[model samples]
Target chain A: MTVLDQGLTPPAPDLIPDPAVLDLSAARRDVDATLAGFLDAKEQSAPGPELPPLIALLRRFLDGGKRLRPVLCVCGWHAAGGDGDPAAVTDAAAGLELFQAFALIHDDVMDASDTRRGQPSAHRALATAYTANGGQSDRAEEHGLGAAVLLGDLALVWSDELLHRAGLNVGRLEQVLPLLDEMRSEVVYGQYLDLQTTGRLSDDVDTALRVARYKTAKYTVERPLHIGAALAGASPGILAACSEFALPLGEAFQLRDDLLGVFGDPRQTGKPVLDDLRSGKATVLMALAVQRASRGELRKLRAVFGSPDVDEQDATAVRKILDRTGARQTVDEMIRTRREQAMAALDHVPFPAAAVTALRTIAESATARQA
Target chain B: MTVLDQGLTPPAPDLIPDPAVLDLSAARRDVDATLAGFLDAKEQSAPGPELPPLIALLRRFLDGGKRLRPVLCVCGWHAAGGDGDPAAVTDAAAGLELFQAFALIHDDVMDASDTRRGQPSAHRALATAYTANGGQSDRAEEHGLGAAVLLGDLALVWSDELLHRAGLNVGRLEQVLPLLDEMRSEVVYGQYLDLQTTGRLSDDVDTALRVARYKTAKYTVERPLHIGAALAGASPGILAACSEFALPLGEAFQLRDDLLGVFGDPRQTGKPVLDDLRSGKATVLMALAVQRASRGELRKLRAVFGSPDVDEQDATAVRKILDRTGARQTVDEMIRTRREQAMAALDHVPFPAAAVTALRTIAESATARQA
Candidate 1:
């Protein structure tokens, strides 16, 4: 029941109007156009036919996913009063997206995820294609897996390639490099903690929370935003304030996601019910539930928590235990509190009113949405 | 028998030195000292005790491995008539070694190598430690594998970190960056070809050789030398000549390695008899053997090749087939011819007499050694 094990698969009953529909600067719109063109250009530069399958895998993996991180980066740059050309901004944003692509590909393989963003995961997709094609059936699975793994490595290498070629200012790049390094290092360490934390429910709550912060919260929001802000030459004081706002916001975001993973409606979440429960995620909410459960509840939870064969009846029993023990309410309250804390942090930072308002709206919607 | 597959392992007895008593230049010696200091300095900077285990793994994995790449870099700088402070050269050399570290770590994981430099591979070593330390037996293997994977990523990131902090001339770094990218991209693509070539022993010989050249020949020796030469601002013509010299020598080095993997003395190679046969490596010799084998010989090879459970009898049969088909002698002749071609290329380059002599000596020793 560690924070890392907390619910993340939230369900959205219906799609909401774009929270980012607030009037964007002309520069921002131009940046978006530029990004679209850049991605198109990358596709046109595919090495050869031998590489088409890999490129397709990337294209499919990237489809229909929210470009939230890149959007945040653009917003952060704007909020910091940076005035780069649209091309520059777009290049930076695309670099961020490529980095995200790399991270997601590796993370999927690491998690053994069968799907991502409502489609077959990259490895599975490649495997499917391999079999459908003329490849040998006996070795096709291994070949596809190998290809997917290498594709992830290629993406990571290409991320740096994109950044190196982006023609950004040296002063700015030097400043941003360490921040990016820290982001990478912390996230990896956070993942290490996460995989190591299973069944260690009685560990310190603060330790679990810190792990969650590094693994999900910072990587998801803070670092991406900081990258943009750093490029803008934001002072340390200002960057610190943004991190303060981002930390709580990111934590709330993950907490909400965790809640959705288990308790959210399937239609809203684009997922089946109790995915995290079935996966045996060691989340904060689960920890809280385990901590406060009655002896009988604890015994039942221990019996079925990680069982691959847990039936619908067992899932219902676990859900009942979650509700009866008041952990659900506790987690819900925590999410609300964190969201409020994020807003409070923002109050101390000076930002353009429109961007600030947009960020606030995003915070509220992110935490409160059904998904 | 892809070119990339040729250098999949260490060079044969005739390509490498004793793996001991190799002469070290002042620059290389200085770089080694700096690396020791840097490793110590880095230990104090990590977030927790987690680094110790990782560092230990790296130390074990790196120990006894020849710093040939780094040495090549330093020698190249010298050959190009560059005269810089010893400390700076060492820092730059460290950069090269760090990159090598990244390469080796990732390569081991990709190859599923059980041992490196006669010790348990990093992943297996970590997994062994995890089990011995009372970690969950079920996940001990996974933990080790994941840790090693992440460790490789860390080495890559930190390799850049080292270069960034090396305080080398910005102009020099710019000159080197594109070359570095090419080196990395070519190596990865070569790996792709090598992996894709498995069981393709009867495929085109030229394609296999091409893969081998890119994967092993270029990356192992050519690029490291180029990095040094580029930093020294060598003329394009001079660099071109260096490449001509390096390419074939590198190829010969790998060809020798393939021979050792299959037929060299087991004690010296530190591997079992027919190791490559069991592992199913698609080497130049294997491809050649397949091409020249009679129908009966081909059947025997098909039965033994890539079989994890290949027995001594199967190994003897396969060896007999390779010998009978004259493939072993052909490969040996190929290695000799490539070595001669490498020396001939050096004749066209107008380097200083001392440099020419030193490089020639290295090439001669590198290509003519046994174990």
Candidate 2:
């Protein structure tokens, strides 16, 4: 059973409190140093005249983003009764982070998102660069979009290469390759379903949640943890349990993100309030609101839901409909319910007490964060 | 050094004849059978209940493209002293063709081309379906583009899965993996340079040709051969010699294509006249035209080139300028010269006379093909 504490709890078989945490600053410094060395190696391979632009792309897109995926992957491996060199885990985890870069770049372009991680998105950044360098204004946007698309392709190809070269054994290769392939395929399929769901919101809340679970939850949490645990040769039962733990946590994370998209501080989100309302994204909360709204509320939503020229007043009206229908409270309750369900999954996992404790802390922190 | 007559060509050691001409019916039968098996497997993996749309995409985009890469790849293996099972080579070559599928889908989106292989391109087809299905016009177009981009990404990821499961040995894996990675990296770099070249006309013919050689020739030809030969554990020197032989031939192939893009019969090329001119592609021919034109001719070019709104009269004016400025004949001469150079390289390769003779014939046939 998981024991949540600031310090390591329920120590596993032969487990001790990570002494590294005693000196938290030094531990953070070490991780940063390790990451920097790896990035430098990546940069060196892409150096000189012909490849510098692509290399610059890697650096630009990769920098300033929290390496959350990699850290989670490495920690998952460590928590799975695996130990050798932390560096090896870091290298393997870097592949996951690179895959993240690939996904985010393509996702932004597909979504026509102008910014990501509080900065100009890759396509917009490239378009700005093209314009600043006196490229054609009309075509610069298209060129930038095309280049970003190609860059994402390059990253996806190279992520495979990186994972292949991660010094893993044949056994690990045999186990992980199919999982990774499945993850990649399902994520793309999930994206298609998401884009497909936009204009057709005929599906109920259950169906919308299923789409959200596959499109965001499984990808955002379960896959990375599985990759790490698989590298450590975790048993299938354990992996399944880990996924069970991850899924609800992931769902809650996205639910929180949906709330932030609609109601969070604009300065913190780096996006305007009700951006999802403007985009008419078919969120689980929105679908619930549609199902519960009165005749008048339904009329208001129908008027403003997908109009491209939605004004601030339209957004406010939509928010009023959400509140009046109690959709906001219902979603908040759902998030808490999922978060508890995720913790219950953790309780079922027979991991080491320290790892279980750390994981519980992570789950709470990840889902409860404001931005 | 090379033989033209069928009887005069010595029997190759392990070389296969050109599938296009020799045993044409049998080769067509094999391709048809293999493609059927592939599509059947594809359908089984992506179930209709969940992924019918994705299956339809593969059916439409990959159904009838010319299997030139597969044929050339299998031929390259045989020409390089490989005596592996044709089925294995076919499987491997089919992976390359799938890769080509991925590249074409994305390239069509990037170039915003309306047609591919004489049919509506994937995005266009999807957009047409969307509109026909009574979807919103703007949303349908964006969704089509987004879906196509992700579909390409899916194909690319699947290509790697195909390679990993092909049941090759460690030595073959070592050679093939590096070549595949380098091929991917170089293709992206070449694409970047090609797009960059559109902004300025270079005075140096060699630089322009180098761009063409890398962007089209190497990817379209040499790398496929390299992949096959690497699979066969061909000696380093032999592989190097094969590249030496293939590079110029590949360049000639693209040069011939560039020629066809401009002035060839629509029936032969399966594309309209001035396709390249309308696209404002800075091809080797265009670069030459820029360098060769007089002041008035240059003014005419500057007015007409790269103007997306150019009318039919402007297109005809550009074509007339290409003829009057001798750009057409210059490109023609370049193709012939490159074909000769390629043949010259084959003569210097230290392969068996029988193999060399077969290689020479294949090279000539590739350059002389109508489509």
DockQ of each: 0.37, 0.52
DockQ of 2: 0.52
Across all models, the iRMS values in order are 2.3, 1.7
State every prediction's TM-score relative to the real structure: 0.87, 0.87
What count of clashes does model 2 give?
A: 1
Share of native interface contacts recovered by each model: 0.15, 0.54
Per-residue accuracy of model 1 over A220-337 as CA lDDT, tens digit each: 7788778777777778876887788899988887777777767777776766665566556677777888888899998888877655577778878988887998878887888889
Candidate 2 ranges with C-alpha deviation above 4 Å: A1-17, A20-51, A167-171, A311-313, A323-326, A348-354, B1-39, B47-50, B79-81, B84-87, B167-171, B309-333, B344-361
Query: What digit string (tens of lDDT, one per residue) describes model 2 on residues B210-273?
Result: 6666666677678877776777666888778878877888777776676666666768666766
lDDT for model 2 comes to 0.68
Q: What is the TM-score of chain A alone in each candidate?
A: 0.87, 0.86
Whole-model Cα lDDT of every candidate shown, in order: 0.67, 0.68
